[model samples]
Target: MKNTPIGRLRLIGLLEGISYLVLLFIAMPLKYFAGFPVAVSISGALHGLLFVLFCLAILHVMFVHRWSIFRGFWAFVSSLIPFGTFVLDKQLRREEA
Candidate 1:
């Protein structure tokens, strides 16, 4: 899947989504309820790195596919919402097929 621009974007988006979820559900809870600030520190850093990669992947795909600005904007917006990337994955998979 990594051979093509869309494929790479999908893979990075999935990873970024999972990292965001981990940071939100596990790391944040650990920081607040379990008195483990390190959990957030680690997961937050991972999520941040993945998010930057995701942005770069989006740009790569946008340029390769000639996506409309609105489509690119939607892609960026999807990264902000929980589970949004999974939903975006469905659309991307259709495009891939």
Candidate 2:
């Protein structure tokens, strides 16, 4: 597959989604339910890295897709919120497709 702007953004979105799921479904639950915080600790670390990559991908798309500063800023901010990455993924996919 071509490494287009949309493709790269989609990959970032997928990674972010996985990270969120790990943090929420696996980590948070394990922390609260099973009384095992290890999942949260590990997933949180991975999420941190994914978050950075997501930020970079957003910056790249800001130029590659000619997104406005406001749009890019909001999009990047959205990733910090739980489940926001999924919404962003949908929006970006719609625009790209």
Which candidate leads the pack in TM-score? 1
Best by lDDT: 1
Candidate 1 lDDT, 14-57, residue by residue in tens? 99999999999999999999999999999999999999999998
Models 1 onward score TM values of 0.97, 0.84
Regions of candidate 1 where Cα sits further than 4 Å from its true position = none
lDDT of 2: 0.83
lDDT tens digits, residue span 1-97, model 2: 1387767877887788789888988889889999999888899999888888888888898898789999998888778777887888878777876
Q: Report the error of model 1 at residue 59, Å.
A: 0.6
**Per-model lDDT:** 0.92, 0.83
